[model samples]
Every structure is written in structure tokens, then in C-alpha cells.
Target: MDPGFIGDGRTVAVAERSSLTFGVEEEFLLLDASSGVNLPVGDDVLARLTGQASEQSRHEFRQSMIEMVTPVCGDLQQMREHLAASRKAAGDAAAAIGAQLVAVGATPVAEAAVSRPAAERYERIIRQFGPVALDPALCGMHVHVGVPDRELAVQVCNHLRPWLPVVQALTVNSPFHAGADTGYASWRSIQMERWPSLGPSPYFASAAEYDDAVQQLITAGVMLDEGMVLWYARPSARYPTVEVRVADVLPTVDDAVVVAGLVRALVATVTDDIRAGLPAPRLRTSLLSAAHWRAARDGIEGQLVNPLTGVLSPAWELVDDLMSLVGPALTRDGDLQAVTAGIDRLRVEGSGAERQRRIHRAGGDLHDVLVYLAGATTGSVAR
Candidate 1:
């Protein structure tokens, strides 16, 4: 089939035959440099950034958090360079204001008051959700992979559902919250469950069905807007991409690159299957939710619900399986080697959650964990 052009006159490339563009958005917490406590100075940090860096950075839900988004990137190397530069710019800006940028899922130390930014939308969210919106320290990394259209994006979401848990396990970074270990690798994921629109997106056979589902949520006042559809993966409201929101904000640029590569590869692999008329796996939403919980609870250290067979298996085995599944796509994009090395590093150094736990165990406090995260955020620490 000749992939027709969209209204914009650009050629609609098939994913199986062409490399898709992708980008990443990472959220970071601003902390006091010395005390390592949450600092509500994200605006100050944003003010310090100039030029393109300023354009790419913005205030998050809370005054203590800042989000840095990369421009659309075509390959993993460009993605890495952009992520590293953005992290540095944000980190530098934070340091100038006597703050540090820490790229973990959640702050370990408790905030006396989680301050909301001066936005009407934020105020409305807080009023509607009440206490759930109060703690805005939960940070996550969102990856956007280009798709041809909304219909294809919806189909990609269905194909991507089964692997959401595996993605979560690989990027678990929040082990501690409020000065105590939450016993879950991604405490941010558990905290996010307080909202109504949390967890894996339901399977939608087409774009119309997906639109209707989101509309229903809005009609029922469950979601403030289409942007508030907080599923693990969804059709992007602002771009021609499928946004994957499963992982925690990682501690380093290298970690973020690995995730971006894998997500794009997965999208490519699924799009290829779609082009070949292969049916998407019809897994239950409940099973995906349970698998997500397990991934959040144990990360890569315990058993996960395997996507190939709905049985429990070692997390690394699942990771390996995922790599095998997407290997061809990764290779085509020249990302396989870098992704493989990154995974090997994760195996040796552990996910951000395990590394935080290790640092806390050695240093005997959450402050020590924060110190390490502050350094890791900008690749200042020795590996």
C-alpha cells in the first residue's frame, strides 16, 4: 500500500520501512544544595536559563519541580546529546539559585508545603483533586514517538500495553518518599494511583473509540481535559506521536536515552506488525494493571508478569525478551549497541531505585541518597 500524504503535504511514512522521530521530556526536583530538601525555586531556575534552553524548560505542577523537553530528535545519539545539554543547563540554573536539580521520581525528604505554580489550570486541578494534587513532587519521564495519525497511535497504544510493566521495571527510580522507604521501587507510580485516570490505557480498536473514551471521562468530570488522560501510553494531544508515560524520571542522561531508544523501537516494531495486519495482543487491562503494580513494587529485582506468556518470570528475563523482540528495530536505527551497553550498566549499577537504596544503606539516611541523586542528575558522580 502506498502510504498517502496527510493534509500537510508531507509523506506519511510507514514505520516498518522508515525511521520514526522521537523526543523525551524529563522532570526534575529543585533541592537546597546543602540541606538536600525540596526547594520551591523552579521559577528562579527557569529564569536563569537563556536561549533555546529557556525555551525547552518550563515549570511543572509544583514550584519545586521543573520539566525539560527535548526538541524532536531523529536518533539516539542526538537524543543523548540533547538530554545531557538540557540537564546541564537546568542543573546550572538551579545551582545559581543555591539549589540543585535532582532527577529522581520523588523527593525523599518531606516538603513542609508543596507550592503550586501560578496557573489557573493548576489551581483548578488542586481544587478538584484536593489532597491528591497537594503533593506535586511525583516526577516522571514521558517519551514521544512519531506516528502517522491518531488511528495508528491508538493501535500503537494497544500493541504497547503489554510491555508497559517491563518499561516500568527498567526505570524504577523512586524508592523513598517523605523520608521513608515506600518499599516500592517506583513510589511515584503508587502515589499516582490516587488520581482517577491512572494506569494502562484500555484497548481501542480505532481513533474514534479512543476519542469517545476520553470524551466520556471529560463528560463525567473524571478528567479536566484530554491532556489529563494519564494513561501509561496514549495518542499525543499536541504532536503526531504516541506518548509513553510509564517510567519514572531517570537519574542520568544515559538512563533516559536507553528508555527513549527502547520506546521508539517498540513503537517501530508494533507499527511494522500493524502494517503486516498482525492483530494486537488482547490482554486484559486488569492483568496489565497487576503487572504494573508488581513492576513498581519490586522493579527488576523480582518476578514480573511476562508479556510473551502471562506467567510470572524473572525481571531480567523479561527485559532480555523485550530486547530480543525489538532488536531489529533498534539495529535499523543504530541504537542497539548503545541500548545494550546501557542495560548492561543497569545490570551492574542497578536501577535508580536500587542505587538509591544502596546509597541510603551505606550513608544511613535519605539525605545521602539526595546528595547522590543531585550528582547523578548531571553526570557529576563517578559510575
Candidate 2:
């Protein structure tokens, strides 16, 4: 990457309201349940996929776990259809290989010895981020939707900051790490936070400011290049959209789709609000942190920080309030029910963290936690 090129400066070639384009990618762990250890499957899976494209699909993360990508769709129905099919394909591949894909945010066992994904660039990720590099502990979901203009993407990135914690709250699925209870709903969030670039980022007054930050990181060697600066959220380097990376790895495909719906609505709401020339709200990163901490600590059981009043409130109440606040956006994006219902279900049922704790309580064995997750890996489950 040229030190001067902070963003690709790519404008959407065919942006249209009737033709909204969205895509989401989630990471998982590849493990053998009986042994209860990290298993690297990327190489073998990649080789198999390359030989017979009919049975396997490719994931940049390589194949320790599979990633499913959906084509850009005009409506939620189309997106859902593609997601369902993609997920089935991934599940089929996992079964054929005798290794199931586990969707928990952080794997129960992420020891240092696991091999890096087969890529020189990702190896550079290890090089750039250093100890935070092993972020083998990292797993997340990222959403991308196209925009007509590049600046609009930058503006959307700025405006979307206030609501990121909402994404953080809705997808807190990782509760265990390396056979021990880490006590964070999404241990991956805390683990990834160890990276220098993790946390609330500066609000870019313009893409120029965004570019400047990238340039500075490159100059300081803090980042190998723009790609290394994986702030909680950032404008996608390869696409003409802002990529939101705040959520943990959701357990089921439905949870993944629901979180995508909310994030897509939130982004469009912020974008449309900008198009109308409304005064931008002051998105407080500090307030966002408090909200994030609650999501990390209590998951669905505890109160969340209100984005407006800056006070803690019950998680159910906050979820209701956010769904209401983003109603217009949700409706405009055709994702209102899916996002809201998913939130309600999660609020009522409990977070993955809570479930893991309950399973441990009942069995009085940590292996049972792993055993359950192993079985849970192949199939989908509601929160």
C-alpha cells in the first residue's frame, strides 16, 4: 500500500436504492470435539475446494473454519436466501471433513502453537500486531453495504460510531477461552482489545483526516500499512462501503443474519440522516465504552449504557429502545422485524456466555462445555 493511499478512493460504479448490496463474513474455529484442541484445517480444505469447486468454497481466513459469502442482494429476502444456502454449503463441507465448524467468538482452546492461516499477508498481520498478533483468540462478524460515493462512506463511518455498542451488545457470544472462564461475554472482544488499534477511534472530520491517521500509522510503523489498523470499525479497504467490525462471532446463521440486518439499518439510517443535512450527533467514544463493557461483562443479563442519557439501564429496555430509535432505518432497509425479534429472543433466552455457564453448572465439568459446543457446532441454535 502506498503510504499516501489511505483509502482506495473507489466510488460505487452502480449504486442504487432499489439495488442495495450487502455482504457479511463471520469466523469460526475448526476443532475435533473429542480431543478438545485447536485443529488447523485450512490447508486441506483449501486443497479440496480448489480441486472440486462443486463441494467447497474458499475463505480468506483459510479453512481452520469456513466463511460464507452472499452475493449483493436487492432485498432482505434475497440476502437471507443466499445466506441460508451458503451456510448449508459450509456445514456440508465441515461434515465431509470430519471437522465441524464452531461459531463461538473465541475457541475454548486457542493455544500459541496453532498455525497461521496460509497467507504471507496474514503472516504480516502477525508481524504488524505482534503479541496482539496471535489474536488467534480473535473472531468477529463484519458487514459491508455499498454507497454511491466515497465521501458518503466516510460520512457514514463517522455517523455510525454512536450506535456501534448496540452491535457489540447484540452479538456477545464468546464466554469461554482455553478451558477456563474468562468472564467476558465475548472474550474475543477483550482479547482483541490487546491490539494497539483496538478501541474507540478518532472521528474523522473528513476522509482526509482518516487518510492522515493511516499515513501516520504507516510512518510510525505502528501499522504495516492501512490494512493493519483494524479499529473496531473502518471504511473497507477493498470495497466502496464502511465495514462495521464491532460484533462477536454469533453461534448460528440466524444470529449472524439478524446482526447484519441491524447494522445495515444503522448504517443506512446514519447515511440518510446525513443526506438530509441534519446536524450530526456527538458520538461519545467514552460512553460507547461503558455500554461495551456491560455487553462484555453481563451480556443479556445486565444493564447497558444508554447512548443518549449516559446511564445504565436493563438490557431488555435498552434493546427495545435501540430497536425503536432505529425503526425508520430498519423499515427503510427492510430489516426491522428480523433485527428486533432477534434482539428480543436473545434478551429473553440469555447470551452464549450465560448458556456456557449454565451448562458448566449442570454437568460440573468443563469438558461438557466443550462437548456441548462441539455438538452445537454443526447445527444452528437460537440464543
How much is the lDDT of residue 90 in candidate 1? Answer: 92
lDDT (10s digit) by residue, model 2, range 309-373: 78788877776766777798778766777777777777666666777788988986767776665
Candidate 2 displacement at residue 272 in angstroms: 1.7
Candidate 2 residue pairs that clash: 42-63, 108-178
Candidate 2's TM-score reads 0.87
RMSD (Å) per prediction? 3.3, 4.2
Stretch of 10 with least lDDT, candidate 1: 1-10
TM-score of each: 0.95, 0.87
- Mark the regions of model 1 whose C-alpha exceeds 4 Å error after superposition: 1-17
Residue range 58-135, candidate 1, lDDT tens digits: 788988999999877777888889899999999998998898899989877766668868999998898888888887
Cα displacement (angstroms), candidate 1, residue 349, comes to: 1.3
Quick one: best lDDT, which candidate? 1
